[model samples]
Target chain A: MSAPAILEVDITRKSFAGRDGAAQLVLEDLRFRLAPREIVAVVGPSGCGKTTLLRLIDGLDHDFTGRIVWHATDRPRIGTVFQEPRLLPWRTVRQNLTLVAAGRDALADELLHALGLWPFRDAYPPQISLGMARRAAIARAFAIDPDLVLLDEPFVSLDPTMTERGRDVLLDAWRRRPTAALIVTHDMDDAAALADRVLLLSANPARIVADVAIPPDQRRAGPEAAHVLAQSLRQARAAETRPGGAISGSSGRR
Target chain B: MLPAASTVAGAMLHEAVAGPLLANLGITLARVVAAFTVAMVFGTALGIAMGVWRRLDLALDSWVTVLLNLPALVVIVLMYVWFGLNEWAAIAAVALNKLPSTAVTLREGARALDRGLEEMAESFRMGRWARLRHVVLPQLAPYLFAAARSGLAIIWKIVLVVELLGRSNGVGFQIESYFQLFDVTGILAYTLAFILVVQAIEWVLLQPLERRANRWRR
Candidate 1:
């Protein structure tokens, strides 16, 4: 909590033209920051500009206002697991990992083994199950050994068991690499299980409602603690929906 | 009169072994190979360029449409007349005829490329060559195969016309000479021999390659 922030996000206003030629605001006065090696989960309602925020940070969308500052010599190396797997369909699992590593990096092979994708190394995307494909995508993220990783709903469509497995592999890779991660998810359980902090967002024209931190001891307190934290997060977001209920960490400017 | 099937078969075997049938067929096949190579290579390059850049696509789109709808016979005659009946002219004419369709198919392929995958590649900052090899080319494989299949068929057909009109030693020329003599067996023999060669190519080369490239689809 005390380390200097590695990435500072201050978006004063971001919007795009609607279908009727009118501008629709998505993120307004939205601001957040990630310290070195921090893991933050952004939980928001559907279509609440969570993905848009990640896109802004990732430079996928440049139409947004304000700036994202990276406190480093060079732009931070990034590994992203998008909402979809986005694995190359024609490439084998191993080939997909090796592609971004600029040939074959040892980290690629090690991540493959750690992520339990080594056995499916030769399989193409269509040949593998959805869970495996998603895991492969995560492995590719870690293979680059980036300074920051962005995950947009890493387990959106998977069943509960697969979701847990996905989180397990993600955490495993993260522990080994220990880089900062910004995870955008709709599920608070996903946030509690994976992120050290949670950022709650309001509905349309999303603004940060609350940024809740999980205590270090409570995080180590296992599934019960995560469940209790998840419940509190839901309550905080629910409470922030009222007229005078915006919590701390809202409108983070400058 | 049309010759009997057995008689045509006998003539085909005899002509393949002992007549101008082999020599003429060889000439036509060479043109097919040359023109097919030129059309595929140039068409793919042009199509990818158009696919990647909207300005290039817009500028060249109408020109491609004109070429696509242009009559092959007209192009062949013009090439022969303008280029002075040279071998290069024949190849050029045939290649030009097939070029438009190949470019069109690849253009669509380039345009429909999976944007999500492209974003992934961009985020990873893949180099141009690596992106082409791992991301772009694989996605373009189906369209490339489509172009090659149609190009091979069309190039061979146009090569015969080029040979019949300008070049003097090909299956088309051989058929013309036999037409003057009114020899049905000779005509049938050369036609049958070429059909068999094309069939061999389709079975041996194209089908195998298409299967191998698309194996991942299964």
Candidate 2:
């Protein structure tokens, strides 16, 4: 069998109280595991509880009915890049990174330098563009050298050039020290490029509709391979949406 | 402006006006500083607590509303009556007048703090003090500055009124004494002195600090 899992998540059910005070389901019978030092991406459309899933894994939301077990001797330190840059508006870019950095001065500086943010180190969040702020946030996540890194749609709303640069920075950081990563994204290309395994989710009360594993060698095959993988995944997704697909909603259990 | 200049000039020229004006100015400035500091410190603390804690907000919101709507004159008169016209009574009265509004402003600031930042803090495992310094406080700085700005305006006036009503040595008390004797020049002199000092404080201190705090906004 594969190497022992580093994270085991078995979410039987998760729901929220709607405005009318009725219990509405959000996630159902979801089960997944990430191998040691593996990167997995969860792909779904907007409002498919992608963020909610990341929050649960990051231990920020404890209200869900499930178990997210970090299979380690000690609790793994977590670093999360949120949907928004989430930088302190009053603090400079360097200050924001230093605030969460785990005393790795050189690494923090290098991340800033690598991201082309060295010149704007003293600039506040509002003083920088959203793309730059997002880079600072990415730097903050890697500076800690966390045991687990969580990213929530970090490349959304950016132009293709910036998106490619962000992906490069993220992959470069992950390659340096292989850490367990759980990324949530809607983009098929990002999923193909960044994840060893890509899991798709259905609409509200989400369940894993498909799980496509990209071989370790194939994961490093550059943009052309990523495009081909994305196209195939798109076809699979479309086929599921069509009538009489093999997957049904009744058995959501893994 | 002409009336104020002439009154100040006349007071400076008149030997009898100089000694009392200097003494009263010192006393009034000290009172304003003390009352403003007290109001700002206590008001910000209570406001942040209320903003963060729902139960505390529910418990104290009505009391804040009552204090906000309460008259400064009534508070000063009541404090003087109860505390026997002492310095404590005067300072307490002024601070109480400004506290509720400061609290209200800061409460809004606290409520408006971004949850997204908070989640980032939590995920990074930032400690309480670090989160407060790096995340919460920066977000709340604008509100704190706003509260201090508006509160200072209200506070200085209340301090003067408190002196006029109860204390015996502040600019307000000197004005009262001049009022009894119908010395219009002396009265105008104290008012002008107070106005000039307040203007100096705004231009030299508050404006620079505000600029520093908001430099990041640009």
Best by DockQ: 2
Provide the TM-score of chain A alone for each candidate, in the order shown: 0.93, 0.90
Model 2 accuracy (lDDT, Cα): 0.84
Which numbered prediction scores highest in TM-score against the true structure? 1
Model 2 residue A49 CA deviation (Å) reads: 1.3
Which pairs clash (backbone N, Cα, C closer than 3 Å) in model 2? none
DockQ of candidates 1 onward, in order?
Answer: 0.76, 0.81
lDDT of 1 by residue, B127-202 (tens): 8898888889989999999999889888888888888888889998888888899999998888888889999999
After superposition, the stretches of candidate 1 with alpha carbons farther than 4 Å from their true spots are A244-254, B52-55
Clashing pairs in 1: none
DockQ of 1: 0.76
CAPRI class assigned to model 2: high
Q: Native contacts retained per candidate?
A: 0.69, 0.91
Q: Compute the lDDT of residue B20 as modeled in candidate 2.
A: 64
lDDT of each residue in A96-124, candidate 2, tens digit only: 88888868878888888877889999998
Measured against the true structure, the TM-scores of the candidates, in listed sequence, are 0.93, 0.92
Candidate 2 C-alpha error for residue B124, in Å: 1.9
